[model samples]
Target: MTRLRIVLADDHPLVLMGMRDLLEKDFSFEVTATLDSPTALVEHLRRHPAHVIITDYSMPGDETYGDGIRLVKYLRRHFPVPRVVVLTMVSNPMIISALYDAGVSAVVLKRHNLNEISAALHTLQAGRRYYPPGFQRDGAIDARNKFIGERINSLSPKEYEVLRHFVRGESMMQVAESLKRSIKTVSGQKISAMRKLNVQTDQELVAFCVTSGIFP
Candidate 1:
């Protein structure tokens, strides 16, 4: 059989070239194109479709959109959607679950190396769903503003981890333990974070995370 066609989209040039070299060397994949923007990737797809698209979630863009999540959704909606594999530093539950719901084929935390990408691609090619195990853990919520307009940061890296765990049915103690922190510390952080975000409870925080793209 012919090798599967693939494309890469990430703002990091070195990372993009490195991943391309790895995939082309190790797999039955033929990289058709590489791009730095989701918009450009979309335009390329209209001309020549690929079997898979490996995109970075944190790709830099104008103030309008930051991650490639929106691009994933667009592809899923357009006719002849290609299988998508999102590579991101973010492993938050809100984002992962939403991408899954949007028909993303795989979600891999970018911390994984070229070997992991090969494994993910192989698994998907074999007709199985792939989600990097242990995506979210009991994490704390950071309320420092991200400086993106008037929006408060809402969640720090650690806090986002806490938010993901709490939203996924974990409790305060469970979250603290998973995060290797004290219960009181986690509790205080959550409460303070909620206050800053103007949210009163865990459920509300979860809802906000999904809607505001704060953690997701």
Candidate 2:
């Protein structure tokens, strides 16, 4: 089997290590280079071509190539345009839409499990785009802003995790135990998620979850 040549770019050491480990262990990839900053990434890419580039949008870089949209645009314009998989902590719909417009093949939230990364890479390899559910490359302007109002995409990673347990009918205590967090912390995250979803009561929250298909 011909291994797919891949490049990784992230500022966080732990995240970079974790991603490298996950890709090497679970996927058919050959991670030729792992770069800590956009400068290094650009430098490496100038000398070597890769099949895919998995990068974090908010990593350290130069003024021109500094992370987020600028770096993505740089990659799109300069390189041969390898399949770009964006693993980011930013869940803002506007920024994500910009990434799609900038030629990002897949956008995976860092909060999601490695499975999402695999799914994204598969989709990109098959010549398709991968956006989180409820997000479209070009949707209504109001709909884009309202996405945060109705979708979990507005929630922080931790809050999203808490909501996953809450929708599964888990109590705050159970959720805390399962997540190895304090009950108070779990409750706070759940409440925060609810606020982001614009739900003021438990009944409304559960209804939202059910209607959103977050719960079976």
Q: Which residue segments of model 2 deviate by more than 4 Å?
A: 134-216
lDDT of 1 by residue, 49-84 (tens): 788888887654322333444556677777255788
For residue 206, give model 1's deviation from the true position in Å. Answer: 18
Give the C-alpha miss distance for residue 202 in model 1, angstroms: 20
- Compared with the true structure, what per-residue lDDT tens digits does model 2 show for residues 24-109? 87556778988988889989999999989999866532434666665677888898568788887656565677788888888998
What TM-score does structure 2 among the candidates reach? 0.61
**Candidate whose lDDT is highest:** 2
Best by TM-score: 1
